[model samples]
Target: MAPLNSHSYHKVLALLAVIVSLVVTTTHASTITRRLETIPYLDYTGIEAAAREAISDTLKRRGVDESDLIARELLGPRQLSVTVPSCKKVSKRKEWRDLRYNEKKDWIRAVKCLQTKGDYGISPISDTLYDAFTQVHQTNWTDFHGNAFFLPWHRWFVWVHAEAMEHECGYSGPHPYWDYTLDYKNPTASPIFSTDPEVGFGTHGNIPLREIGQGGYKVDNGAFANLKVNLPIPHFLTRNFSAWKDWDPERHWGTALGGSFSPEQVKIALKAETFWELEAAIDGLNLTTFNDPPVVPSPDTPAPAGIIPLAGIHNGPHFFNMGDWNGPFWLLGTDWFPAGVVAPNDPMFWPHHTNVDRTFWRWQQRPGKQWEFNGLKGANRTDDPALPTDLLPFYGLGPDVPVALTLKTENWPMCYTY
Candidate 1:
């Protein structure tokens, strides 16, 4: 080929640059389009005073106005100076680190108090801490999961458990939580699961020959072991340990549903930039799991690409801690730690869920996003719809608590910070 002059060579170079720019712009536009399509949309409406006027009025008589009620309800009570001279009542929930030595002791005392107390009803379930959870589980298990109601429902559960510990057992301190992300690699090794007789959740139990053969074990140690828990029948608390393993059909579960159960997963949950992504990750898709529809991921599942991942955030720690899914496991009564009706059987369920609640509260702290609730509708069943005015019915907790009022972490009944 004949050599080109400098002017022609410069023209060629400019032409190449233009081609490259067009290609880049097209690729970027496609990426934005796919992301916009894939990202789930959540229609979260702010709690309206008109919708909750009745509840607001009731709270007003107790000295809480609408805005103050809403603010404190979602975030918990605001922090005030020692001598601020205020009459507002709020419940303060603290982390484990903040508890005094005596406070820890009192917590244990309160747990024991509930453990020994009378059952709400139903004979042998009796008056123990286990019974309370069992009652709530039995009553509301249908309402909480597989919908927008999941997060708020559990938030109410945790709050009332704290209330029971305080009122029935005389615990003066707020409910404490275990931030499992801090010890993500091996949760069993953490201090929260220490062998301490007082506060620890205890280590894994002796893996029975049956369980060991099938790759399962029990959490039968620490303070929780030998502690009576009443499920269908009275039994000692149990646990088994399993490090998070990424879901792969061939390696992890041999064709079961798949995903990673790692610290990174929790971080992904916390790092969600938008509320819709956060809710989808945490609560899964708000469709009915009861029908086992094809749209819903299979059991022990993660949403495949282009599908809305259900319970993506909440599923991590459950399976990670429950570990291997090889069958004949007694604690879970199945191959895995079922996230459904019976999960609260584990005492760790409380703290694990408390951490979930904390994450929701933290997400609320983000600007322009603090006050939010699910606005989506048209599920398979009308009963499962998520509405701000919907009541989170905790049977035997006296009156029905509205979802709008409960969104705040620190409100009239609950006054504390993370």
Candidate 2:
């Protein structure tokens, strides 16, 4: 073959480079398109917006410190739900991406106050978010998990906690939820956890010798530094990611982000045609009754012929953030991130449960399914029947609220829709 001129060879190389670039871009776009199809339209839009904001916010404010701004908010007001002015219960729990500038400040200020409220006597018991966590943690051994009350019980827990932030901590915005599935591919880097110092929750920290997977680090920066989690003996919030041994991080985008659960699973759970289907998928509960033992089904368990198997969306964030399947399962005792009892100590617990509550609220919005019940009894105690009129055992809301009242998303005292 005749040798080509230098210019001809250079031209050939340039053409090859362009072709490769097109192939790469096209492949990336196609992958995103396929993943977007799996998410429900509303969730897809929210997730995409959050992802973009995470990138943009990081770039715009990187390396700039806002500790002074945070300090000012902390010193401003000791807003507690008790003394704060009474306001209408908000019906919208907007996604993090949709929050206004002032709204973000309100959340940061309120959270900081709740964490620091230990100094105040506002909440007969320490006056901090930890107060609520302890209440739930102390009683978690009961029938809350793996039962019908899982949804309603948590719904009550998060609502009251938000109120504490609002009424006690002086925060003025509705509680926010972290849709982990939005950045299921890269949760550690999600905008919700951005290290912006103003609105961010600070990125995960380095765990000296135990940094095993994608998200194994103690969150030791931003607004939640030196947090007095798990009271009496305070501890900083930590996170570690774990998943199946054979999982391919590249192929399994959603569940791959340290959670055994996936965005596809959440989508599947949302597709539940009936309340029974939604219940089973949400908590892995037995469809017939609420008396069955909580089933945390094997990673490989399949849904029955017709019903969508337990999606583990509820269990996903728990295990994703708590269980280091590849390492020691941190469930209790030492750290706030591990175990069921103390998991709520981590600030992430509020947003995590908020997402779960959002899922339940979304299910309730399905056509003609406003008030629905599938599993057996109402309360963890056998005394309560499976009646809407039965009262939930949740306290701290002044007078005990009824199951009938808690069931409706827009009812009195309970007014918020995800």
Give the alpha-carbon lDDT of every model: 0.50, 0.50
lDDT of 1 by residue, 1-418 (tens): 1222334333333443343233222222110111111112110111222224333433333343353444333223333421212225665556676777677667876776776765454233455544756656655354565556667778877776776676667777767877765665455566777767777767767844243222334556666666655554444554445322333324332111223334555556566555545665665553324234333344444543333254354664555455222111233444332322445666667777787888888887777445456533222443323445345555443333456666666554445567
Best by TM-score: 1
TM-score to native of every candidate shown: 0.65, 0.63
After superposition, candidate 1 runs with Cα above 4 Å error:
1-92, 122-129, 207-218, 243-267, 270-276, 284-311, 323-340, 375-385
Angstrom error of the Cα, residue 98, model 2: value is 1.3
TM-score of 1: 0.65
